[model samples]
Target: MAHITIYTTLLCPYCHMATNLLRKKNAPFEEIDVTARADLREAMRAKAAGRNTVPQIFIGDEHVGGWDDLFALETTGRLDAKLTPRSD
Candidate 1:
């Protein structure tokens, strides 16, 4: 499986939804809480190409955006492919 990283805030509902979906998929992810850390938030923004939103997700270096983006992937049945590491 691809390594997952998500930048989130404690009170964000979207973040919770995103995490829940990942849990259902049995995907192990590193959740980085950026609620009280401006530096970390800035880092997330930089990594996300200036998308300074809660729940910035990355799957093995591929930026997956936020909850909506992730959900779209799931709904379109494209998420599984992303989660599986390429054998190349």
Candidate 2:
């Protein structure tokens, strides 16, 4: 299975949208809620390179940025490609 990770908050609409899109693709993901966790929130900002925003996503080890980036990947039909684990 593909390792999809998303840092999100309960009140963030963009995070919900991102998760919704992933659900549409039948992709399983780990949703880390950063609302109540200060450590995770700081980690998200660091991992995202100072982008202190909700919904920092990662497909495997590749950092896919925020909701907009994920949407772009979907629109370009590359989301599935990234979601598929390599056999070789």
Candidate 3:
């Protein structure tokens, strides 16, 4: 499984929705609550290039943007391939 990291705040509906989608897909993920960590929020901003939005996602070291972006990837039929591990 690919490593997934989600930067989130407790009150964000998008964050909850994103995680729910991942859960429905049965994808393993780690959630970092930026709400409680000022440093982490700063780091997320840097990593996201000033996008401080909740549900900022990272897939195996790749920045995957927010919930809409994830859904867009899914709609385009690319999410599954990325979620699966490649033997080569």
Candidate 4:
């Protein structure tokens, strides 16, 4: 599986939803709470191309954007290929 990282805030509903979707799909991910870390929040903003939003998701070095984007991918039937573990 690809390395999944999500930049999130404590009180963000989208963040929770995003993580919940990942959990439901059994996708492995690391959650970074940017609300408690100013530097990480700034980094997330930079990665998001100046959009200061919660739940900025990255899947294997690919910037997958926010919760809406993630859900969109699933809806479009593209998220599984990126999330499924590769067999050597």
Can you list the residue pairs that collide in candidate 3?
Answer: none
- The Cα RMSD of model 4 versus the native structure comes to 1.5
Question: All candidates' lDDT scores?
Answer: 0.97, 0.92, 0.91, 0.91
TM-score per prediction, in order, is 0.97, 0.93, 0.93, 0.91
Best lDDT among the predictions, by candidate number: 1
Worst 10 residues of 1 by lDDT: 79-88
Name every residue pair that clashes in candidate 4.
Answer: none
Q: How much is the lDDT of residue 69 in candidate 3?
A: 96
Model 1: residues with Cα > 4 Å off, grouped in runs: none
lDDT of 4 by residue, 1-88 (tens): 8999999888999999999999998888999998878899999999888878888999988999999999999999999998974776
Error of 4 at 41 (Å): 0.4
User: What is candidate 2's lDDT per residue for 9-87, written digit by digit as tens?
Assistant: 9999999999999998899999999999999999988888888888999899889999999999989988888999778
Tens-digit lDDT track for model 3 on 1-88? Answer: 7999999999999999899989989999999999988899999999987898888999987899999999899899998787876979
- The residue ranges of model 3 lying beyond 4 angstroms of the native Cα positions read none
lDDT of 1 by residue, 1-88 (tens): 9999999999999999999999999999999999999999999999999999889999998999999999999999999999996799
Identify the runs in model 2 with alpha carbons over 4 angstroms from their true place: none
Q: Please report, as a residue range, the 10-residue window in candidate 3 with the lowest summed lDDT.
A: 78-87
Q: Compute the lDDT of residue 61 as modeled in candidate 3.
A: 78
- Candidate 4 lDDT score at position 70: 96
